[model samples]
Target: MTKIVLYARVSTADQTIEHQEAQARSAGFMIDEVVADKGESGLTTRLSERPEGRRLFDMLRDSDVLVVRWVDRLGRNYADVCDTIREFMRRGVIVRTVINNMTFDGATKDPMQQAVRDALIAFMAATAQAQAEATKEAQKAGIDHAKAAEDGRYLGRKPSFTTEQFQRVHDMLSQGAGVSMIAKSTSLSRQTIYRIKDNPTESAAALASWGL
Candidate 1:
């Protein structure tokens, strides 16, 4: 039946599922189920690190087809990216890209073609890794620049709700509401929910109490 899986990841908040969905739909692929890794940035953070990404592996079976917008969506480190792809391919999984309709199939009998394919994979993986490193460096420079300008420097994504919003999240967490439910209730991401939960005093002190 040609079961298909779609994976979407955003290293930052500005990027959203809709953006990826539009890209996938334009490629003429109906996404069966999408696995998203939101707000995870480390190049070293493999699919296992992402809550949804690990689940995607569990859902995959032999002969399943996995589609991604690009190879970088899988990973940013060369060895990590290539090894994971090879493992999936070994398991009778087909890895595909929507960008160029690129397909990697290890079943090829042609030695020269196989070698060329491997070489290309290596080059692409290396490029992805380099891009990740470059992003980190550029982010650092921006942070330093902001700090010098005294523009309220803060690393990573800002809490969308501010201190007041975080206090509400903390109160909800204390009341036995699950993070997922709280996020839905408050219109914040689960990561923000946990961040607020983990830092109650700081969050509370940062703003006046709403008297929960």
Candidate 2:
């Protein structure tokens, strides 16, 4: 029997595994198992390196259907994501994304269909990677602009957490703590922890804006 597996990743604490599974379920996938990597940055971590991610790769078998929320959930690197999906397809595993209901299958015998499928995968992987880079650049630009204004006195919006709290959150993140765990330890919301982890400079600027 063909089994269905769901894989989810959250770079920040705010994102939830349930949400990803829900999306897959809504797309009509009868998931048999779920593998999730929480608070792990796709940009920095390869799929093979993640704890749950590694298990997902090992658990997948021929005829198994692997479902994800989007291509980015696989990895933020274009090459890595494409390579991983292709490897799965090569093993006769069908990979699908809930976002666009995109399906990749290696069972196609037609050359033209294979070419089209390969092209789409490349395009989607590249687009996902580009979007991640663009977001990082935009965040950096916003911080730079805020720093330049008011004779470098404008520090952007005020931060919700204190300096000590920010430092603790940073330490926890550096030590590879999970988002939920860090949020609990710091007594801050998951969203705030995400903001701190994703853009440290912006977090600092916000703190400065509040004269913290």
Candidate 3:
């Protein structure tokens, strides 16, 4: 049987696997299983490196269907996202996104059809990556403006984790603890832990903004 699988990645705790699954179901997809990576930033972590992401890759078989909210869920970078999708298509799995009801299949032998599919994939991947970059640049600009106006008193978004908690997370990361372990011990989401580990400066700025 060709199973329908849903893969979801949330960069924060507020996002939920259920939401993605619900979106797929609402779009008339009968999902057999859901693999989710919570608290993991697509910008920093490659799809194959994520714990749940690895599982998703292993679970997908030839003729299976994989559904995601969008291509961004698969990856944040253009090359990585395009490569991952191509890998699946080569394995005979069908990839679809809920956002535009976009479908990508590798069954076509027609040269023109293949060209069209490849073009679409490239465009989507590039667009997804560009959007992520633009959002990050905008955030940095806002922080810079605030700092300039307030003599470094203007903080950015409120800290999602407390200083003490963040310290433990930092320590765990330094000690080479796995993301899941740190998340479990600190009661923090994987995304927050990743943010703290991958970008300490940004994390500190957030704390400073909160006057913590």
- How displaced is residue 189 in candidate 1, in Å? 32
What are the runs in model 1 whose C-alpha is more than 4 Å off?
Answer: 151-212
Q: Which pairs in model 3 have colliding backbones?
A: 39-190, 39-191, 155-209
Evaluate all candidate structures by whole-model CA lDDT and list the values in order: 0.68, 0.79, 0.79
> How close to the true structure is residue 200 of candidate 3, measured as C-alpha lDDT?
65
lDDT for model 3: 0.79
Superposed model 2: Cα runs more than 4 Å off? 145-212
Worst 10 residues of 1 by lDDT: 203-212
Q: Can you give the TM-score per candidate against the true fold? A: 0.67, 0.70, 0.69
> Considering TM-score, which of the candidate structures 1 and 2 is the better prediction for this target?
2
Cα lDDT for residue 138, candidate 1: 39
* Steric collisions counted per model: 0, 0, 3
Q: Can you tell me which runs of candidate 3 are displaced by over 4 Å?
A: 149-212
lDDT of 1 by residue, 1-212 (tens): 66788888876544576667677878898888788888775387887677887886788878888888777778887887888788887777888887667888677779999888888788777777775665455345544454454555343333356533453354344335688877875688887777556654433332322211
